[model samples]
Target chain A: METNVTNIIIEKVKKSRISEVDFSNLPFGKVHSDHMLVCDYRDGAWQTPRITPYQGITLDPSAKIFHYGQSVFEGMKAYKDENGKVWLFRPDENQKRLNISSKRISIPELPREIFMDGLKTLVQIEKDWVPTTPGSSLYIRPFVFASGTGLHASPADQYKFFIVCAPSGPYFAGKVRVLIEEKYSRAANGGVGYAKAGGNYAGQFYPTQLAIQKGYQQVIWTDDNTHEYIEEAGAMNIFVRINDTLLTSPVSDRILDGVTRKSVIDIARAEGITVEIRKVRVEELVSASKNGSLKEMFGAGTAAVISPISGFGYRGSDYDLPEMKDSYASLLKKKITDIQYNKADDPFGWRFEVI
Target chain B: METNVTNIIIEKVKKSRISEVDFSNLPFGKVHSDHMLVCDYRDGAWQTPRITPYQGITLDPSAKIFHYGQSVFEGMKAYKDENGKVWLFRPDENQKRLNISSKRISIPELPREIFMDGLKTLVQIEKDWVPTTPGSSLYIRPFVFASGTGLHASPADQYKFFIVCAPSGPYFAGKVRVLIEEKYSRAANGGVGYAKAGGNYAGQFYPTQLAIQKGYQQVIWTDDNTHEYIEEAGAMNIFVRINDTLLTSPVSDRILDGVTRKSVIDIARAEGITVEIRKVRVEELVSASKNGSLKEMFGAGTAAVISPISGFGYRGSDYDLPEMKDSYASLLKKKITDIQYNKADDPFGWRFEVI
Candidate 1:
């Protein structure tokens, strides 16, 4: 297996694209690396994976991914430490979550070893794309989608697993101003809420755009039935600090089980801060704001890291949270990144160093 | 404008793909006829559309459609009668509903005339593909997705509108047995529940697959908070017939405003049946079954027309709904199909004949 893998790598290097590309002035997702990893699924098995130059793929209009939304993805960054070594932070977690998402969406499972191998090869081949500039890194997106040509509403027989790399930046331009949507929701019970599926993201566009029209950066979606409980923001797990207690929506079938969400929970515990994970009703937050108990709020995700919410409008009432001098969000973000960049001790064994 | 359009069509046909070929056994969505209609939003304007052959187009991986859940679609069918005529049932309603779904999802709208003209041309091009046999027609899928590539959680400045046709059979093979999901929901209030967004379908796969494992056809999702109010089936709107009245969930933002659902309501009215459109609690349904008031239940959608429900299981209790016979569901299905296939007078003006 090792020698075959080495031969595949040597072949990939021989087949690298001939395009001379400037890394600077590169837009987030515009400039692609020289090589990409492609794997095929047919006859109920994932065939031998191959690496090739970035190119267009032909798909039937009825391919299940385009029609049925049978697709899921993960976003992780490749960081270059001071020693010129590449490190991936808890990528095994992403691979596991991808499988979890696959199981929920009824897509075939991807073995962890295959997933890790694909990621390692793609990153190694595209090492030059990783930016050493401040607040910049290579953004790697691993996705799986159904690729069959039948139109019926069933799982696809053929699937494609591919890894694509993008030159990076802050996902959100700056700080965000969100609106707590009291009416619309993204996912619900028995829904694909916990998975990083494409459909879950697709459903949020119109409503989040509506919020954008109203001058909000994102919409904090509430529960479906009464629309009373605060579930999550569009891309991040939400946290509201009330009276020194961090309150957040409980992880359920209707919300994505975010890795950053778990990290925040752990960081809070490590800092001796009280964190409550239960159904945080929208009314409770409003009441806390009125009572002057609400101190700060932020959103946590892998892409944006930690985005502080400046203000939120709920039912047309604007509520601005007070800024904190010693914010848990900023603290956790630093601690996590420090560990990821190998600048701090990996007390939690979160960082996996790749030599 | 009309003359220019006619001349353009004639000239386009002069240079189109080789049309004289065998097209039987096309296999669902694999084959496309000569022309496909595509319109784009560029410079904040929806440019006039063009019709071209079905081909693969490439996009940046960061396209909002790929990353966010900003995609929505509608399923509508066109049929041919025995007298060598083509007709669409409620095409106007579908166009309007598509707009509604677009508005809810932040997608650009395809003008009514453009939509109708595009459908007519494509159906005309594939008229041979529309089988004239009983229960055979061409399935039309009109969908819009954000086309810009960026990792930001904002609505795309650009959008693409595409209408593709498929040769489809009955969606469900046999009488469907549903599992009443007490823990999951398909849509929620203040959510895109009533919109035919792609994410809404993706969310149902896991639970419905579980239902399939349990020997059920689909999972009937309930309202998210309490799982009390019945929302809809995976792809179709649900209807339950109590002793004499037809009880169905009210059309709310949390339930899809199915075109067939409203048609059934009109058919029930025309048949002098009492139709109640309100929240139908799960408990009330179970009680109705125990008391023999629940005579039958079925799902209404464009694909299946009306799919009868054989039974449902919920909360450790199994209830068997009798296979419908000489029932309102069957009668409405017939009356509705009459207009769809142009077999009867379209008193409701539901059928639009294409010249």
Candidate 2:
């Protein structure tokens, strides 16, 4: 990787406690590595960043994120194969998405090079945290927040950008059963649902808990204006297969544009699955299921990779989906995992390796 | 109000020097107070509270707030009225709302006693920072966050509850023009829009910025499913005057139950002015504006007691409201301020003196 971008100023590093942290059975998001990256903007100029010790930073109580919720974050993972090589799947897409989320939440832009450098150093320092366990990885969180100090219901004047890593295992290795929510929506046309902002998830907690209390594991949110169209399930983008045709909702301002969702779409397209990215209404899907046209449904995200939807509880009716012996979700998930674990050919150049 | 409420745990305070702070009329949020209150929850109990020099708390990069945005907060003001009487305007409402916000966001409930005792202690310690100038007050922020140590797209087990205060003044005291957005919605049915969650505000930053670019100062968000109903201004509850009757949208699951809005309703009723709490549609409002039935429209909130809307741009048309010679908003704002500053009779028993 290049040492610097032409216009950006990289900060100096202040090596923190070099004490080693074991990756063996590391719990997700509990242990952070040394040398976190930070950049400050004042007088409209992003100052030189510094890699400092992982310590608590002071913030005013009225900081915008604490009040207005002007915060957005991204979840990514870094993998170290048996050959001691580090691989980042679709890092560029993440940086771009972070920018989009920043703009949506009124946060300043983070330079792409800074994002990369920070990730590389953090992984190198906490390299042992990447577990060798199957279905386990190092979860990386890159977030930007409004650290401005005021009680006004407005955009913040200052911010804090950070990246932290956590060792994580499989979220849900087995199948997922979801409930279609015909009332609540995760986001609206003019809402922050699509962005990785903290508010969207906060909004879904109560309803999701209600769904969980009612025996369903997750709630699949529908369109805000009309609960007719299926948007997303929990925090992941969903895909349905109807007689070998892959269908998923088109990414709108209201729905998150997931990195895994895009990757799955590309892989499915390469496999000639005839993927359709458009509105897939609940009525149409429910009718197709009754008519025996709907084959299978699954969710895609960085955590789960891919999770087969075994069944869906619509209102009061539960529609049982057949477990395909040759499911597309399993196939795509395996292919993506293979590529991620460096077990498959990197034909599309999707994986970027850090030496 | 009660002496037995002191389940207070005295904690050590740490100081950090931010010598590089440029505080020359620095913009809001650019500077912070010396210390911040932090309390962590795990194992069904809150840990010993601590007040540390404001600094960043190390967190797993994959914390749920970063990815899912599961966070919520509250806004309340601490006033140093004349004679140095530190008063809180309806703190119980803020504490109750904070609990409700935490419940909806899936963050653990901060005990009522902790909220009250914490605020009193924090403000007392920082009492010298309380600005005494006219219109200046210490903005107290009591917030709870989902700072769990995992990233499974689920609710967090651990949380951090804090109360930070900022010395500030009115946000939007003067009148400004606003637009009625019939097409874009802020919250949806069965969503966390009513709560002062972070995600709700994050989504509005983009659309509100767009409105600002169009020369409008604020956006009055309507119902998502149908834009026919007028809901609220971007950060305040809206009140529309049709003749002598004041009408506002009822607090539904989709609308924030603003404390100021409720107070205004109570004052109007006390004055024998008929008040109605129901859905105010955009068409009806526009029609009323056309026939001179719309006498005035104003927004109510803690930050801005009553922000009169001089004009509203709706759809493809603009309507300038005629200024009221003796407006209800002006009268209510004056009465509320008088009570808050201990200048007039607090008929509603709203203010609570703290030492």
Task: Report, for all candidates in order, the number of backbone clashes.
Answer: 15, 14
Candidates in order, TM-scores: namely: 0.91, 0.89
| Per-model C-alpha RMSD | 3.4, 3.9
Model 2: CA > 4 A from native? A1-35, A52-56, A117-133, A284-292, B10-39, B47-67, B78-86, B120-134
The numbered model that scores best in DockQ is 1
Error (Å) of candidate 1 at residue B224 is 2.1
lDDT of 2 by residue, B1-355 (tens): 4553655455534543334444333333334566667788888878766655555655554456556666777777777777888888888898898878777777888877777777777777776666666666666667777667555557888788876666665666578889888666788787787787877777777778888898899999988767888898878899999999999999987888898999899989998999999898889988999999999999998877788999999877899999789899888888888888877888898988875
Write model 1 residue lDDT over B1-355, tens digit each, in one string: 0212421131134454435433443344445555566777778877776676666656655566656667777788888888878888888788888889878777777677667777777777767667665676778887777787666556788888878876555455568888999776677656677887766766677778888898888888888777877878768889989988998888877788889999999989888999999888989989999998899888999988998888899986789987666887789889999989989988788888764
lDDT by residue for model 2 (A30-107), tens: 666655667765556566666666666565455566667777788898887878777878888888899888887878
* DockQ scores of the candidates: 0.50, 0.49
Candidate 1, DockQ score (0 to 1):
0.50
* Alpha-carbon lDDT, every model: 0.77, 0.77
Q: Give the alpha carbon lDDT tens digit for every residue of A190-253 in model 1.
A: 6678889887776777777778889998889887667788889777899988888887788888
